[model samples]
Target: MLDCKPASTPIEANHRIKADMGDPVDKGQYQRLVGRLIYLSHTRPDIAYAVSIVSRYMHDPRSTHLNAAYRILRYLKGCPGKGILFSNSRHLSIECYTDADWAGCLDDRRSTSGYGIFVGGNLVSWRSKKQSVVARSTAEAELRSMVSGICELVWLRLLLTELQLYKGG
Candidate 1:
């Protein structure tokens, strides 16, 4: 897919990817592609959410899942220079933002939670994963995401303090 057309976005907005959307695809191929995407997501947090979605169907991938994976590749091709850039900053305030889609999964009605941790206004951590427990309400889903973000923030704060880089608020 070296010469393939680039996609403007990694995924379609509000796209519901179900298990039975399309014909079955090769499991090995799908797993390999998703594995590579997962590795890439470590440094390309922009694609983390999309990659996580595609990785869900690795066990029994369908045409729809394959297409979603292709979209990520196309997105990467379009933005070859996209990657995290960390520079020295004087400020060290920690900020975290999190959100969740309540019952976003059509198959199992599970919500996906995501969070981003920023230190000194630079993104230092991020994650997008399906919640283990099904949330009862939108507020619950949001709280679940916030809890995950808080855990990460606590760990970060501890690490910064240990290194003598954190200033007590």
Candidate 2:
């Protein structure tokens, strides 16, 4: 891993990612780097938003787009030791939180949905994906994201229930 500078936040508060319609560059290198970042996102939820944003421009990345991706790498260097930590605890309740940005994508006008799922106070799963269909309103987008979250919660609950049964609960 390259030594990188630390960013106060994974992404800029007002930063927005779009299709990089600028002049094309080496597509292979850009795709490789983006793929690495996506894998890193498995352990670093903080970079999820920024990575997802830059991924939209994989087909035609410009200098500006590459710079943004490099910034994330620098941010990662600062928090090299940061990762999900699990602890031994009796509490195994499943809970989740969901949020959405109504019409956040400027190009397609699709909403961005984010959700985090936790078990026994430890984050087990999370996501930041663009909604498939454009939402007519903010409430609609939020509701849809919540529905996705609920699905995750249900699956988690069932999995845990099976685990308990195996342990003779």
The model with the greatest TM-score is 1
Worst 10 residues of 2 by lDDT: 160-169
In order, the Cα lDDT scores of the candidates are 0.95, 0.84
Candidate 2 per-residue lDDT, tens place, 1-169, comes to 3645677776778776667545666888999999999999999898898899888888888776787888888788787798899986677767799999999988899998999998878899999999999999999999999999999888878787877722213
Candidate 2 stretches with Cα past 4 Å from truth are 1-4, 165-169
**Candidate 1 displacement at residue 35 in angstroms:** 0.0
Deviation (Å) of 144 in candidate 2 = 1.0
lDDT of 1 by residue, 6-73 (tens): 99889989989998899999999999999999999999999999998999998899999999999999
Cα shift from native, residue 121, model 1 (Å): 1.4
Backbone-clash count (model 2): 0
Clashes of 1: 0
State every prediction's TM-score relative to the real structure: 0.97, 0.90
How big is the positional error of residue 123 in model 2, measured in Å on the Cα after superposition?
Answer: 0.5
lDDT score of model 1?
A: 0.95
